[model samples]
Target: MRTLTLGTPRLTAGLDQHHRVDHTAHRELHGPLPQLGADDLITLAGLGSLRGRGGAGFPFARKVRAVQTSVLRRDSTARVVVNGTEGEPGSVKDRMLLTRAPHLVLDGAELAARALGSPEVVIGVADEGARAADPVLDSLRSAVDERGSGTVFRVVRMPDRFVSGQAGALVQGINGRVPLPPGTPRRTSESGVAGLPTLLSNAETYAQLAVLAIGGADRYAQEGCASQPGTVLLSVSGDTVVETAAGTRLSRLLSACGLSSARAVLVGGYHGAWLSGEEMSRARLSRDGMSEVGGTLGAGIVLPVTGDTCPLGETARVLRYLARESSGQCGPCVRGMPALADSFVRLLSGEGSPEDVLVAAGIGEGKGACAHPDGSAVFARSALRVFSEDLSTHSLTGGCSRPVKGELPLPDGYDTPAHPRLLVDWSRCDGHGLCAELLPGLVQLDRNGFPEEPDIPVPGPLEGDAELSVRMCPALALRIRAPEPGSAR
Candidate 1:
């Protein structure tokens, strides 16, 4: 949990001041966080126009209202779930909050529980490989005994997949299921986590709530812009974490990070848009400000692209990652993403048809159960728009005339997606056609009575029958090879 402060630190107030993780340090540095009733909290959030720190940027007050209303209508105790799964490859601010100021986040979570009458609070951190790496988990364990609030605290490590951070996915994961978004649209605020009305939000949202609670609405609004008055934590590459006021100009941030010479910037994380150097100079760091320049403050990641590398090639690598991280739930996300990546690959290799990339992007928009496909579309479309010259060079001569330096920050050690395929060990086969008989839709028999493999990965619906077929195979020749590490099985 490295830290950097460009302006005043609101969420990270005590980190640089006290620099301690234990209870005494937290209390002595920032004092106790104020407890507010549900109505007061809602009012404070509405006055500040607080938005979720997660990519969605939905209104925090509205979410609180919905959860409160649902719990009232159902006459049940609501559960508060804190989502600390920072799955965005380029963002680490959430990890910073979790490690440096665990109590601040817990303060926010406890306050929410008191407001909603929720006795239980669950904090979902990712597995050890990703954001839930040792530093954060250790901080959380140490903070547990220091909690003075009466609310029960439970910490669960989520799966380290990209979509596992989605509200629905986190809810599903907490309930002992695979952390994937559900097929239908069911709001977590209404029905979540074992059929209880749940108040769920990302890690940074809770941290902001803590700041508002401790400092009051007037003090909280003193720093940021008029539209959204608050501070935001930004992950500017893995090297530095910047905390600045909302509505700060992108150019100012670039200058502060020694990136004034950058030609273009990848605003937000991978799912975010790209801004040209000219557009970036006028862009603001706030939500409305980013939208004015055709971008959003998604995950608050601002990565500058210098002129030294091939922009098209860099975008192509991120597209490949986006394609691999798909949940395989919808047609557009499963097929369209790979097609988009392939088009970029061909363009980088000098054989691309320009229309294929845009066409694939269009096909993927709004076609997934989750926002994964739509985000991929946004990234692809923005790359095409912002890197037109690079695209032109690649399309014409199959090369951008510049070396690929891998400037864009991609997830470390992200394995390629391998679609689940039927594999046969021929030595163990006895020419049995049982596998073909059990799942005739996927398997076909060869002339020698051996099962002929299907070309595509097995669909999720057929997994039951496929597993049954594997078990029923008399000669043990048929089996399904699991998909690659980052792929959806």
Candidate 2:
């Protein structure tokens, strides 16, 4: 494939030191990954502690086995994709590997590609900084060029949108479709990238693949806890102030980036939880580890929150932004999130109700199309849990009164959520009759005016989004929102 290299985060971000694979040597070692016998790969992965890098930290063996079995039963060419779209706001590990150690990342992708029948290995990238995409591209090119053996493929530079980093959305974008997440269930390993049985994983996961290739399972298992082995990259931006041992419980880790002097840490992404005080301090960065703390190791992203701002207000702003980021494919996410956002806003403004809190927590606690709903719900729940003190404070007095510091990241929340209740943007809209006519239960029309929607809950399907309402709207003002969370699978 490409001239491989291994080991990254040259800066040694966290407290732990990662023993990464040497991509160059890793390339030489790829002499056919010894066709792992049944459960052998999973055992090896488990031994190596091959936790998924996509933040969720699902065991590689779990996904590997799932994809392996799925492909074995189906008679189709299995495919693979290295999702390099690192879109979480506070996290920067995947692109970090790409920019500095492209070969390592590519070598990882190649190693997995080889083990999995050398299926189409498409490395996709769309980093936060324009500068980020180049390094990975250069590295992938070099690795492919060096192999001359022909197996590696091209690196696709994706458009840098928030959800474009999602595995399904990324696959859809690569296959020449809108870069939005899908609603109905579609597994990447089952049907991904051109309707092929594909094995799509995050960029860091690929790099880890290369590492596992060269290190073998034993070398991979050397570090980290037993439940799940390996060192995980964590962005400590969640904490803004340095926490002392007494005030913080920082994981004595291989790499705790940005944790030098922190307050709280956003354990997950935007949809992640905000753990403050000892909660942030004591937390570790691993699937098994984060799980122990009621937080997840999703996408390997963590933001440490310091005293620079009020955690409550910061979370509120982030909630609003996440609401907008909803693909608008499900109702729970499209509308429910906005409502929750408003609740958070009201709380921040000292104009909230206890009922608001209870309702926000209950609405989609169970029903929704995707994990976006769950993710948002988790964020809301965790926010309430941690910031409850703030809410109580606000209730006692007028409000936190702290300015809604935009410090909480709403990476794309600003541009999307201005739909203005029912106002339509005609030029951008073509009445497919979807908004008004599609789901008459959810929407209706004014006596002598435009279309209108009732307060009915939206159905999960896009048609429920009311294609007729969209078709009928002279201006495409109505957007269908899917209320679901995204899984690494």
Candidate 3:
């Protein structure tokens, strides 16, 4: 990767070797700064839809307004937390900034702290690799040593689980509470860290803020799209991994990094969607334009689904992994994800029928505490839209017979248990087989009498005796899927 790229196109120009915190370009996080005048930050954010790098794609304006409002209104103490914790796999942009450009992220955090009258600033990060975390922390320490009275900013080590970085969970952990989101829509802006109004955002988002603080709006807007005038960092991975001999040139590397040519791009990490490896038609990468095509800017990690990889099978495996990642906090998500995974696995094997698709969409829809389930559903549904030809072949053949080559996704290991399904207490199961009757494609019956669903996606369109068999089962073990992401029509 290019260690120092400046004034380039996309969200990466400001990035140094470090992904999350790039302090090399900025001066210090400060001993303190002038309190932010109302509306100063709103302008500093470029007064545009500069989207947050975090997958939520929240507007920077809204965040500024929230902090701006809190500053203008609330009386108690307020704080800022630069959330460097990346719970999602395939995400390393933040780590890059933290390890290499620590100063920049700290500057942004410090700016927010000073602007919002937040005396305290906490940088929360959890690393998947030990080696990556220390450099980031050390860089942070140096920034602090240069400014703070040795105490203005703090870096907190968060729990390693994927669930830890969640806003509510992060608040809970900092406060010595459990690291889990509350069941309600309680805002972190209301309570954070330890009972203080907090302005918290992903590490990369803060890094962008620092970039804006120093570079000014004109420099930042130079190469970006008119809508989202900024560059982004993407972690590019390709099939047929190539390690060059000592003589590999920079240009060849850039091409491989996806600066040239067209291929399926996995944006926003795993929760992102796949784009057709169309022509270089997609000349630049940004937010709104990608969404117009059913994709997101994501967390800025772009993994290429190269030609050699079977996009279908790879998508199937990712769906399954994301399904398991569900926190199981909500009834729809916990129950629906497994069903969605099963439906895709079936489609991969060519066993999925028409009825299966409908139910999978139903189960995986808006049922989760967060948008994870809905996002995964969007991924699956879009994959079906893009790969209808593949689906047709699988339907005709009764199975893809492709051996599920492990491409298009990182290895999640083999033998992971199939996510659990809704079960019927046979004692409660009235033999009415309501479940089998309701979702016949999903649930069948064994000899003795119980719903038996193949651990795969049930294709849409089922009928006849097999359908009748499930219909007879009264126990309703056969709940259909939720409406699924982006599938209301």
Candidate 4:
């Protein structure tokens, strides 16, 4: 990944010369880490109006204050968690920080631990295995050794699924449980990671904090807009990571990355909303700016698609991937998401109405265990709005006659499983027993005639039957898919 800077660099100060900045080099570039107490750090964050860069854009000061309050009330020591799990496929800023600027992230994490009176600091990266060869895990481990700070830092691997980066889910993964969000919502500041008050934020957020600490609030506030101070990192088109001031024009950043124009830009990641070229040209890279453009700087992902590809087709592909990536713990996500994806696919094929997509998108709004459903809804709705021209073409003429270029990227092992399996989309399935009859060895029908197992891996001998069943399903709900990224084959 190439790193570029628009203005003066803070978190990415020394990255131009060094691939990975070590502790000694980091100190030389940024100067020594300043010692600050809990109140001081919180005050500094408030002065800069720092907010978490992990998509939510919550005020960092409020989170620290809430954790401190919980610590005192519970009479418990807090735990500091640095969430480095950048599960959004289009996002790589956090991973880049963890790999190329490990010390900066560690410095911020250590400062938070010291302020919160916590001895344990946990850094959660996506599960690339426990092997020391992993770049992110290795860089963090080496940095911890070099710092030799009094506080203990433990780097743990988290599931690399899309929703695994949720604050609650990250905490749960650090606790060694399944890295999925809890059914009932709970605040990490109150009880997290072994039921202790936790100060958890994304990797970039902590790196930004370290930048704040080194430069003080005044210097940090000098670069970006008054509302949002300091530089923000953006993962653009999955190839370039740019560190630019908060209010930098979106068009300028795209030009810097060699993208002069586009039909639509996906501001944020898959769960984020889409923006037409006009909106993209007028947009800024801040929270308020993105809101004005009817989007969010979700995980700082900026992806643009030119007119060569069908925008609706691209959106449908992403929606389908998002539907498959659901945690499958709630009705809204498991059932509603597939329906949403189906609606989009049908629209893309000119076999469904726009109302179908709208209704399906609303099925999961405000109703999932996590924000996946709502965010997916936002993405779908925005696509419908931004790509209305493309929608009309597809609806009237059976398509725009343009192919899906797959401009939006999915992770390598994303739907491509090592083993092929039979999967069902419950939203379209109507107690169909045709699959069960065709592939009795691989599928079984329950009393309701629905497949007893929604998902089943196809054996080598049963591949033929699986194919026949998939082709013969009356509702067109059965499909043969490879194992998803985190699923067991």
Candidate 3 has its poorest 10 consecutive residues by lDDT at 239-248
Worst 10 residues of 4 by lDDT: 412-421
- Whichever of 1 and 3 has more TM-score, that candidate is 1
lDDT (Cα, tens digit) per residue for candidate 4, span 408-443: 888664433223668899999998588866765346
Q: Over the full model, what C-alpha lDDT does candidate 2 score relative to the true structure?
A: 0.59
- Specify the highest-lDDT model's number: 4
At residue 167, candidate 2 shows an lDDT of: 78
lDDT of 3 by residue, 344-389 (tens): 7777557885368557767757655666667777777767766677
Point out the higher-scoring one by lDDT: 2 or 4: 4
Task: Report the number of clashing residue pairs per model.
Answer: 1, 82, 63, 1
Count backbone overlaps in model 1: 1
Each prediction's whole-model lDDT (CA)? 0.80, 0.59, 0.60, 0.85
Per-residue CA lDDT of model 1 for 1-489, tens digit only, reads 457777887777767765655678777756787778888889988987788988888898998899899988999889999999888778788888888888888888988999999988999988876343488788888788777557788998887767888888899899998888988869988899888989888888998888887878888899999998889888886556889999889888888888899989998888899999889989999999999999988988888788998888788878877776776666666566767876776778678766888887877688678888788788878988899888878777868667767777776643344235567778788877887666654565789987664333454445677688778878877678876673310
Candidate 3 regions off by >4 Å?
Answer: 1-38, 46-49, 127-133, 146-151, 238-263, 401-405, 408-415, 420-489
Better of 2 and 4 by TM-score: 4
Question: Can you write out model 2's per-residue Cα lDDT over 121-167, one digit (the tens) per residue?
Answer: 88778843636346556655665665567465757767666667777
